[model samples]
Target: MKIKEYRTQFINALTPIYDAGEAESFFYLILEEKKQLKRIDLALHPDLAFSEEEIAVWNSILEQLQQEIPIQYLLGKTSFYGLDFEVNENVLIPRPETEELVDWIIKDTATPRNNQGLKILDIGTGSGCIAISLAKNISNAQVFAIDVSEKALATAKKNAQINAVNVTFINQNILETEDLQQQFDIIVSNPPYVRNLEKEEIKKNVLDNEPHLALFVEDNNALIFYKKIAELAQKNLVPNGQLYFEINQYLGKEMVELLEKMNFATIELRKDIYGNDRMTRGSVQ
Candidate 1:
């Protein structure tokens, strides 16, 4: 059938599960990925027909979409921080907010002669997005990432390879680790900060499909990972070494206070594109 003709059916198939806008966007993204056809190509050539086999393949994918599967998982790849990463059920798909966090790290570390060969660690580096991006952007930095899930680290390692960046991947439970064996000039994380109570606030696509190990925390101790990481940062970071986090917008003030009580200096919180206080940074004195 003509690709343009499929658009209506595509929207209809997904409308019950996703909104019109989201369904339409998925259709376009799939068309581009599968057929190498742009939106304008569909618009300008409404009669461009799909082969019977192509239609069948699209039908199967559409059924998955109707069942609420994420488009990124369906494609098995996603773009983040200007790099393409392979993702699956094991790793959370990198988000634009996290891209902002990566940009923040890159800009902060790009100063001339500033820790040019410094060691850096990215905690909870699901899909190795932050670690790989940093290594790709900062020419002289040594990067490493830690995750408790071996499967997640596998995906992250693949991403580093695909991005042509060298990043050491380690599997360890950060909360249980007593100390970092080696000091780092920078430590960054986008750890699980969503409280159990706030699960209702998360979109169904996220709460249903994304890995919970990478997304949640106990409501009573929502800052558990941050606290532990801060303790390690105190002992592991060299003088004036930096610590960065992509934070929970709702807990910005608490995070700032936590860092302050830890005696972190030069604490700063910044808003993301949505104007939420979504990232924070501080330096160990």
Candidate 2:
């Protein structure tokens, strides 16, 4: 069958569940991954064909997409911060807001800090996206990442290697640790900040497929991870060390207050591309 014809069927099958634009995007993503054909290739050729075997594979993926499985997981990989990562049920797929958070850190660390080597840690580093991205971008950074789930850590370790960055992966629950045991120039996390009440706000694809351990918190204590990590930062951050978080959009004011009460100096809350309060930074005094 002609690829373009199959593309129409594919988009139509998904348009009932996803919007036309999103369905079209999914079609092209699959096209690129499966056939090594870009949208331009299809447009120019207009005669590319899909073998029966290829259509069989695509039909399987389409069935899963109809079931609301995230395309990233269906593809078993995703691109984040210009690097590719393997994602599965074990980890939350990296989001654009998290990309903004990473950009902020990269730009903030552009200048040399007194010619000193930098140590950085990422807590709850599910896919090691933030840690590996930073280590890949920053030449002098020694990066370490921590996560509680062994499966998640395994994926993160593979991502670090895939990205060719030396990020030390640790298997530990940050909530249970007393001390970080070492100082770092920067610490970052995108820990579970989604309140139980916010579940309805999550899309079906994410809520049903992504790891809840990386996404939710109790409503009454939505800042549980932030508060705990902030306390650890107070002890583990070097003098003037910086801390960064990708936070829930609705809890920016509370996040600032938490950092303020913890005596984190120079606290700043920033919005993502969508202008939602999505990231916060604080420096140790």
User: Best-fitting candidate, measured by TM-score?
Assistant: 2
What does candidate 1 score in Cα RMSD to the true structure?
1.3
Candidate 1 lDDT over 4-94, as tens digits, reads 7888999998888888999999998999999999999987888899999999999999988877778999999999987899999999989
Q: Which stretches of candidate 2 lie over 4 Å from their true place?
A: none
Clashes of each: 0, 0
User: Mind giving the per-residue lDDT tens digits that candidate 2 earns over 211-247?
Assistant: 9999999999999999999999999999999999999
Score residue 219 of candidate 2 by CA lDDT. Answer: 93
The RMSD (Cα, Å) of candidate 2 is 1.0
Give the range of the ten consecutive residues with the poorest summed lDDT in model 2.
108-117
- TM-score of model 2 (CA atoms): 0.98
> What are the root-mean-square deviations of the candidates from the true structure over C-alphas?
1.3, 1.0
